[model samples]
Target: MPLSESTVLISEVGPRDGLQSVKSVMPTAAKCAWIDALHAAGLREIEIGSFVPARRLPQMADVADVVRHALALPGWTVMALVPNLQGAEAALATGVHKLTLPVSASEAHSLANVRKTRADMLAELRRIVALRDAQAPAVRIEVGLSTAFGCTLQGPVPEDEVLRLAEAAAAAGVDEVGLSDTTGMAQPAQVRRLFTRLRAALGERAGAAHLHNTRGLGLANCLAAYEAGVRTFDSSQAGLGGCPYAPGASGNVVTEDLVFMFEAMGIATGVDLEALLAARAPLRAGLPGEPLYGMLPEAGLPLGFTYADGRLPRTPSIPRQAAA
Candidate 1:
């Protein structure tokens, strides 16, 4: 089913971004189960995995199988992350609905994360776009300006550079460009200003807000993004991941808490909070003994709480991160 105009599009990245940080590989069957549960809970867009070398990210070795499984689900938008033209080719072959690439605004981070200078990455983006235009014209390509706010390796990314990259990405024929708080150095003030500038610069082509909860301000930054007219968001289930390349960059905005915040404020997230909370079970089963983050699971919904669309509340049930 198509989302209503008021619905906030939350792209769940637990399977891709979340798993890439972990050492243990989640069994293929378990990954499918977790994704199935998420889809059942009304999450329409999901980044199932990345198209990287298995030796580098063994956790995602079964990405193609995961994509095939996710594609079987009706009305689901299955996305995948690709670091270069090579990765993009693999993802495109899997028939993914969308492909997201990370382009850092910080020069140091660009080298560290993708081993490419900003200009090289732009060249890569153009190559990927050309390939998509020829091979899979229907697939959408999105670029996330990673380390847009700040960088641990480089420290304090400039706003002008970020906007410049966004313009470059748009000019490269990407469907959209969004800002990512890759190192979790963003404050609410900074988030608002950047996203506001993003909208002003890219208009409808401005994409999701991929915020991190590293400093415990994930929700605050998310709200700031919303207030700045950002409707799409990228979150991880159970707050499962962060940038493995970004030192000390831990925690993604928790999907459960994010959904609750929007739903409680009379904003339609279109996610069934109870169902979303229940999806945590499969994740836990997949990664035994892994510590999950998110306050909504630990604390049940408040009394008489109602969703934005007037969905009645239910009593809740409950449920992080490490090396690159």
Candidate 2:
């Protein structure tokens, strides 16, 4: 499960990040079905769920079961979020391929989200790394520096603080450190600037772009990050999740729209736009009445649209927009 250079890795976080934000908990069977559909759509990496206490977050009470089911899917790199050493231990025991820790750049946001300061989180990361070395040497550890862009709790997080935290996380022995727009306040210019600085600072250890579309800038920020040399992107199907801990936080980058944007431009994402849209069925079925979001699903494909891999439409016709 090393990072693939063949296609931009779209790490789906709907199961973990998405569900956790919602009030209703999806059934275990439905979670598996949704995940299976995502795999069918060519999503190779998925954050199945978090390993936090069930009482704390009942939505993820069956995370271990979900992880086991995702593991059974071949050629998939299953990941789970772990807030601390305890969560990491439980996640490792389930044989998750990777573990992602959220380390917030904003001290106030960090305290609100994980009840730990930046220094305490780093110390926890060291302990988790040591445990990983001892028990699961093959498992990769990633840190999503949440609130890297900005925070609702602490208006604007300084760029220097983000870089400092990223460097600190790298030194704590994690495999990669990525930035998170937990509060959805990132603009395209800021995205490019920070990612560029991150690459310059962390080199290969700098990780994915976890942007939000709160201000309708998710795809734009992603494009900016791509320009800044970030190949991995985190998105949610139907735009399902945001940080529950961060006030007024909402909207993850929509997966179908993201794939469509890249494929329409002839940048292969290795994801089938049709299949990805179809995956939304199980998501809706799992959480009945829940609102789903995405433009491509409603607009349908353009006339004679061709995927980057050269797949043709089933029945090409004049584009509706053009015909109108």
Candidate 3:
């Protein structure tokens, strides 16, 4: 299906990818409120949580609860990350709208992160697809090839390996295949070329760009991908995640900055900037003392700027007390 000019889907991954890397766990009530506020801001798709073992990632221990709450929201395409078939089963049981499986294009990173070889990860992908087919026909499966741009462990990851994994993910019966700059080493030129090639390889199934700002090129890279005809962009509320194994790296692209960039250019992201900022308050309250990153929120909106929707700039009026 062709991407419509009216809207771009910016799937928020803060609850899942953002919180996972943090040391503190966001309370369930706070998480539910955050999801609701994001939905109110016109964000239709959200990665609610990841279905990993609670013992391994305590931050996402309430994945099931979060998924349930997000599913309750109308028009929300709730998503969850599943590492393998086991995680896939758990996510399916929660009736999430989508399930994403991580497949590393870098052999070294794959081994280090998931303790599985590249071939083993592909095998697991096939198993997860089979399980999805059997149990949840409505659930869309996305294979996110991590370290597609470059790997910290192995230095330079070849483009051929990334293509190979994309083909493998499609052959393994995934609905979509996405590329991730897990190590934050991607450049805009590289993003354009790779996403172009992926479009040719996967056709309509080419998935969103999951980028990082560790090297400060995340937004630039995303713009390149957008120029290359990518419509879906994955971002976090406050830029909340990073590879726990890879130190000094930023997580996914910040949602606030991404929304601002698109809306400023009249790209029509369908997300309200003010409401998006309002969503951040709950995130801040949830993860106290944790650092939240966003350029738009810090710099404020551009002078005399207005959104295409025309609902902004009008602050909700507070009811006044009756005169005595």
Top lDDT hit: 2
| Candidate 2 global lDDT | 0.93
Each prediction's whole-model lDDT (CA): 0.92, 0.93, 0.86
Clash list (residue pairs), candidate 3: 241-251
Better of 1 and 3 by lDDT: 1
- Taking the tens digit of each residue's C-alpha lDDT, what string does model 1 give over 191-232? 999999999999999999999999999999999998898899
Best-first order by lDDT: 2, 1, 3
Candidate 3, residues 1-324, lDDT tens digits: the string is: 125664578989888889888889889999998888999998988988888889989988999988998888897788999988888888898899899988888888888888899999899989988898988888899988888999888888999889988998899999999999988999999999999999999999999999999888999999999988889999998899977655555667999999988877777888888889889888888888999898877767765666755545445322233121
Clashes of each: 1, 0, 1
Q: Is candidate 1 or candidate 2 better by TM-score?
A: 2
Candidate 1: list runs displaced more than 4 Å. 1-6, 314-324
Report the C-alpha lDDT of model 2 over 1-324, residue by residue, as the tens digit: 344433588899999999999999999999999999999999889999999999989999999999999999999789999999999999999999999999999999989999999999999999999999999999999999999988888899999989999999999899999999999999999999999999999999999999999989999999999989999999999999999999989999999999989888877788877788889999999999999998888778987799887998655645456677
State the lDDT at 260 in candidate 3. Answer: 85
Worst 10 residues of 1 by lDDT: 315-324
